[model samples]
Target: MTAGTVQALVVCSTASGAVTSAGGPVSCGTDAKGNPLYLSTVQAYVVDPASAGYFDAIATPFDYTQAFGFWSVAFTSVVGLYFACLGIGTVVNFLRRA
Candidate 1:
């Protein structure tokens, strides 16, 4: 399906004989066998304007703060590990010399 029409659909019937779509409601009818039936139809849309981006090209304001926190935690962990390795190497070198 194109950008307009729904690609797939799912139908469900409750114990109370009520049928509902994913969220929308369609027409109800009865078949020749006298069973309640619900029909879901999809129509093609020639134009959809909501897909267009109306916000700015840059990231959201909150995302900038989140990114900063993420990098700060990452760099702090990296620096801690670097110092740990350096201390371990110094201890090993001193032991070898002794």
Candidate 2:
């Protein structure tokens, strides 16, 4: 995807139950044909706050791909702000009677 474009993708869970994805674009650690790696590995661990050690394990399992969407409306808002500020400033200056 090009810059300024929003892309969405599903990310699996990590050992700490955290998920991560590169965001947008079906590229990243893919095969030669541009296919996803399909690496769905779940991680489980029990942290020992005192000893800072605990039991941890991982299971490689594929999960459903969570569909995400992205849209751009900030540009429109920025343009609107620009014209609004210009108009307001002009009005204020004109009414100042200076």
Candidate 3:
């Protein structure tokens, strides 16, 4: 494995039996073997207004290998669409007399 960055997310359960997420996506550094060193013992806390202490806890367990996937046509399609829209907008703006 090689050293790199990985993505993580946090899911929390409040004291009032409410479930929420604190992190949609956060970047973390990996070790030389491309292992998420910090995810080994990762956790997060949240605030619950309905609770006494108004706090919650989240378990942030993730696998570095599970973070990566094979590059697919979806990426290419999105990039293509972006550039296509930009080019169309530029041409439309340039041709406008106003």
Candidate 4:
């Protein structure tokens, strides 16, 4: 619609995720309850119900932190709809007689 809007679309669209989340640098896989299990610096992280905790040593084989889903299908669909509306508006304006 405007130069600034176009510039933002070109510059940030590729790099910025539709949605995002943040977590601590030292983190580990989530529990079955969907809660984050932070890993200890001393050892590898594990998912064992008895051992995993806010601050504790991990097993020899690291359970490893898992990335949660962030890609937004809804946001992408809305973006697509916005572009479609822009296209349609431009076409409609071009076809109209003064």
For model 1, residues 1-98, the per-residue Cα lDDT tens digits are: 23344343334222222334566554465567766656553333432344333333333466778899999999999999999999999999999999
Clashes of each: 0, 2, 1, 0
In model 1, what lDDT does residue 69 have?
95
16-80 per-residue lDDT for model 3 (tens digits): 22222374323245557665423222233433344423223334565555554324456777899
lDDT tens digits, residue span 1-98, model 4: 11111111211122223333364333445667776555332222334444344235433444333222234666788899999999999999988944
Q: By TM-score, how accurate is candidate 2?
A: 0.28
How does each model score on lDDT?
0.59, 0.47, 0.47, 0.47
Assess the local accuracy of residue 10 in candidate 1 as a C-alpha lDDT between 0 and 100.
32
Q: How far is candidate 3 from the true structure (C-alpha RMSD, Å)?
A: 20.4
Rank the models by TM-score, top first: 1, 2, 4, 3
Supply candidate 3's per-residue lDDT for 94.
88
lDDT of 1 at 78: 100
Candidate 4 differs from the real structure by a C-alpha RMSD in angstroms, to one decimal, of 24.1
lDDT for model 3 comes to 0.47
lDDT (Cα, tens digit) per residue for candidate 2, span 1-98: 12132334344322222233574333236556665554343433434444332222234343434222112356667889999999999999999977
